[model samples]
Target: MKLKLNAISKSFGPVKANSNINLTVDNGEILGLLGENGAGKTTLMNILTGLYKPDSGTILIDNQLKEFQNPREANKSGVGMVHQHFMLVPVFSVTENIILGTEPTTRFNKIDLKTATDKVVKISSEYKLDVDPNALIEKLPVGIQQRVEIIKILLRNAEILIFDEPTAVLTPQEVTEFFEIIKSLKKTGKAIIFITHKLHEVLEICDRINVLRRGKIVGEAFPTKTNNKKLAELMVGRTVKLRTSRRKMEKGKELLKVNNLSILSDKKEPILTNIDLVLHQNEILGIAGVQGNGQTEFIEALTGLRKASTGKIVYFGKECINITPRKIHALGIRHIPEDRQKQGLIGDFSLIENIILNTYYEKDFSNNLKLNWLNAKKEARRIINQYDVRTNSEDISANKLSGGNQQKLLIGREMSRSINLLIASQPTRGVDVGSIEYIHSQIIKARNKGIGVILNSTELEEIIALSDRIIVFYEGKIIAEFPSNSDPKIIGLAMAGVK
Candidate 1:
């Protein structure tokens, strides 16, 4: 299969997401698309998958020009996409989800369950995908769920595959396994477009790479022809120091301490148990774990968003449980919540309003019950500039911006407060490469200024990069701890509870 995108251009309102981008993928090749956050990688891929029609472009499949009006049309034309987020039904079995919409049928239009299951099993074994046909998707791990998504594409007989940030949520071992599977697909003569921000993976797996910056293809290189430093420079269009610059710190006393933290669900089942942790001023403590492994419970308990049945949360030598969220906020604890849209920002509120959301009572932005719009706008603009938030109007509603921009706004809003302790969970998730660097630097800067930082993220690179010390959370317990220079493999094993 050969895919060619010629002069592809797409725009959303004033933003030119893809500006005359031209690229090609030959048969049995993995062409990597590298870009900073807000680059046109996702936009271009969306056009290829028929999610968005390019304002102007031509797509050629096997030297024949084609037009895709919808995803079904793209699928029928032998194109398929596996998104960063899987699209499997939770309650349905793998076979059921795969055969949906185009079930195997007889003359009477009756479903053929046995044939579907048999095909799924055969395809799984052939590609080494190893998914169980009868297993429910909700019961599978993140990696297995990803495989099911891939299997869905295979079942459609997709010759061209587009993988968007595929390894963002996998363990180190699972990533290795996935790479092998991708290689197998390549050997089977499938054209693959691999989209990711990780420079090292581009070097490891991709055959050739194209760099996109601000809606244009800036550079192209083969893996063997370039190094990470050069690729990073190309992606950002500047020399980027990959490591954080932090000043040596004289450690202060513990500002936040959690001992024997335990949480029981509404049904009286234990969600978290026997968790002990501490955060000291001038130290960045990273908690590394897979998602849904009690990280949410631990952070929610400390931030006063959720109640824990049994736990001792001491903040600045005072117990924090049973305290209201307002009281917790008043105590100088800033939380950059995990789910930004749900917990961090009010979607209907203007940027100015969201900026002063928790601190509106201050005399600078408000007096008594009245909000000074001028002062609020001034604050919002300051945050926008300081945080490099890309927005044309401060009066625009919070929901209008992209995901990365939304994250930037939340981080800026939270970090502006006079904070003694900061709880940042998945702080840079889904953010672009440049914003990711900025966020990491800010976290380190806060630590340098003697603020106790509790960083929790699923990204192992982030965990290893920004942490002064790291702890692994598994099954609601602190399963392992390591110092700054710990090996990645060691920490990875601990993430899976392998002591």
Candidate 2:
């Protein structure tokens, strides 16, 4: 099988997402699509997957021109995409999620669960996916859930597979396993398009790499002939610093202290159990853990977004447990939430509005009755310029910006204020290498300025790089703690609940 996108161009209003983009992937090969955020990689993939119609282009499969009006048509033509975010229903079983849209029916016109389970089991075995057909998605690990996604497209008989940031959430061990899976898929004569912002990943696994910049294909390179620095420059059209430089700073006064923090769900089940930690000024305390291991609940409890059953959260010697979010904000504690679109920014609101989202009631931006639009817009423009949020105008809706830009905007909003403590959860998640560098620098800057930072991220490399001290969370408890220079292998084991 072969997939070809020729002269593909797409635009939304004034923003040209893709411009005269040309690309191809052949069977038994993995083509890496590399780009910074908002560089039109997603637009090009959306066009290929029939999510968006190209203003001008021809999609050719096996030398025959084909136009896909919908995703179903694209899937029928052996084209399918596994989105960055999983589309599985949390409550659904693995087989149910795989056969959700295309269910087999009995002669009586009823869903055939037995047939679907058998097919899912067969695919899982054949691809070495090792997924349980009866397992619920919520109960399964992220790596296994990814396999379920792959199995979903395989059941459609897809010859062309597009994986968008597939390894973004995977552990280092899982990433190695995922690469083996990709190699196996290639061996089976599947055309794979691997889209990611990780430079080292493309160099490790891709047969050929194509770099996108400003909605155009700037360059292409083979893995052997290229390196991270070259590829990052190609993606961002600049010399990108792949690592952050941190200066040694002594830990200062205590900014936050948590003692016996325990949170319970509405059903009275413990979400966070007996958590105790402290954050000192001029320090970045990195919280390392696998996803769903009480990190989210702990951050929420600290930010006043979630109520704890029992705890004493002392901020600057004041007990602030169960305080309102606004009161927390008053204490100069800023938070960059995990989910950017859902928690960080209001999609429908303008960038200017999102800039002052939490601070709109402040004396500078408001007079307690009406918003001071002039000052708010000025601050919005300042953040846009300072944070490098790529948008044409501050009047545009927050949704108009890409994922990375949205993140920068959120970071800018949180950091622009007078904050002593910054609770940045997944600060650079889904951001490109260029933006990651900037965000890391900003975080280090905050730490250097005597601001306490609680950095919670699933990415271990990030934790190792920026953190002065590290703590591991496992099953709702701090299982272990380590210094900045601790070996990552030991930390990884600690994250897996090994002390």
Candidate 3:
């Protein structure tokens, strides 16, 4: 299939999401779509997938102009998209989910469960997806869930597959396997669109790269001919400092101490074991690990969201165990949660409301039982301007902003308060390089101002760039520790459980 998007233009009132954009992808090739958050990547893909109509454009598939009124129509036209968030039912079996909308019917007019199962199993084996046909979705790991999504697209006989931020949730090992699957699919003459903010992955897997900035196609380059720096420059429309510059930290008194920490599963199996750490004021301690290595559990326990069966959690040299998250916040511990949509902000709430979600009860925000909307709006606008959130009004719902802007808002909300320690997990996940640089600078600024920071991220480069000391976690235990100057290759090996 040779797919071409010609002079696409889309407008939502005054905001032009995509403007005069042209792109192409051929069979047996991977086309990388590189852009920052809110750069119109989502708009272009939405138009292609039939979720939105392009104000002016023509979609040519094999030289045939096509118009798809809905996703089903697009699917019938051999277009399938895998979203950043997997669209799967937790209770459904793999076969059931894959054959959900397109079920085979028996002669008796009943759904043919056996035939669907067999087909799903065949596809899984062919692609080396290794998914069990009968496994329930909630029980499967993230990587397997992703495979199920791909299998869903393949079952539709899609010649052009659009993967939107497909790797944002994958582990390194799974990432390696995913690249192999893409290669295999390419060999089978499939056209793939890889859309994401990660620059290195573009170089690693893509044949050609297209960069978008502010709703326009700014540049395009071959992976071999262009590097990450050049791609970032084109995507951001400026020189982006890939690494944040930071001064030497002046470590202060111990702000938090954890000893013999352990997170037990429902069956009482140890998720994290014998963890011990000390976080000092004016210091940044980074926890680096692949996904699902007890990092999430550890952070939850520290923030009082999860309880450890055996551990001593102390803050300010006092026991903080059995405390609520609000109490921990009252004690000057702020958390920037990993999953922003689920944990950080209320989607239905305005940006002003979310900004004051945690601080609405303060004396300045309330007088007796009367809450001050005036003060809340004032503070929200201040944070918005201070954090460079890209939004015109604070009255708009949080769901309307881009992911990077949402992150900036959350970080600003967390850091603007009186905080003694900041626990930030995947702080820059899904954000662009420009926002990342700003966020990293804000973190360093907080650390320099005598606030203890615990930075947990899956990106090794981020850990090495920001942390004063780095700890590698594998299977819930610290396997290795290194200074800020440690070689990334060594840390990578340690993260993979190398001795």
Encode model 3's per-residue lDDT on 1-499: one tens digit a residue.
9899999999877778899999999999999998887788877988998989899999999999999899999998999999876789999999999999899999999999999998888999999989999999988988899999999999999999999888877777888999999999999999999987888999999999999888999998998898988988998888999889998877999999999888899889889999999999888999999888899999999999998898899999999876899999999899999989889999899999999898888887988789999999999999999988877789999987876778889989998879999999989888888888889999999999999999999888888889999999999999998888789999999898996
Instruction: Let me know the TM-score candidate 2 reaches against the reference structure.
Output: 0.93
lDDT of 2 by residue, 9-128 (tens): 999888889999889999999999998888888778889989999999899999999999999999999998998767899899999999998899999999999999999999989989
Regions of candidate 1 where Cα sits further than 4 Å from its true position: 88-119, 134-136, 264-271, 289-293, 322-327, 339-380, 391-403, 487-499
What TM-score should be assigned to candidate 1? 0.88
- Please say which candidate is ahead in TM-score: 2 or 3: 3
Q: Which pairs of residues have clashing backbones in candidate 2?
A: none
| lDDT (Cα) of model 1 | 0.87
Model 1 Cα lDDT, one tens digit per residue, 1-499: 8999999999878888899999999989999999876687877888998889999999999999989998888999999999855678899999999998889987788899899999999999999999999999988987888998898999999999999988766756678899999999999999999987778898999999999988999999999999989998999888887776666677788898888889988899888998988889899898998777799888898888999888799988888876888898888889999778769999899999999989998888778888898989998999998887877779889876655678899999889868888899888866766777788888888888889888988878788888888999888788999998689889888888898
- TM for every model, in the order presented, reads 0.88, 0.93, 0.96
Error of 1 at 29 (Å): 0.5
For candidate 3, the 10 contiguous residues with the lowest summed lDDT are 399-408
- Global lDDT scores for all candidate models: 0.87, 0.92, 0.90
Error of 3 at 394 (Å): 2.4
Whole-model alpha-carbon lDDT for candidate 3:
0.90
Judge candidate 2 at residue 96 and give its lDDT. 92
Best by lDDT: 2
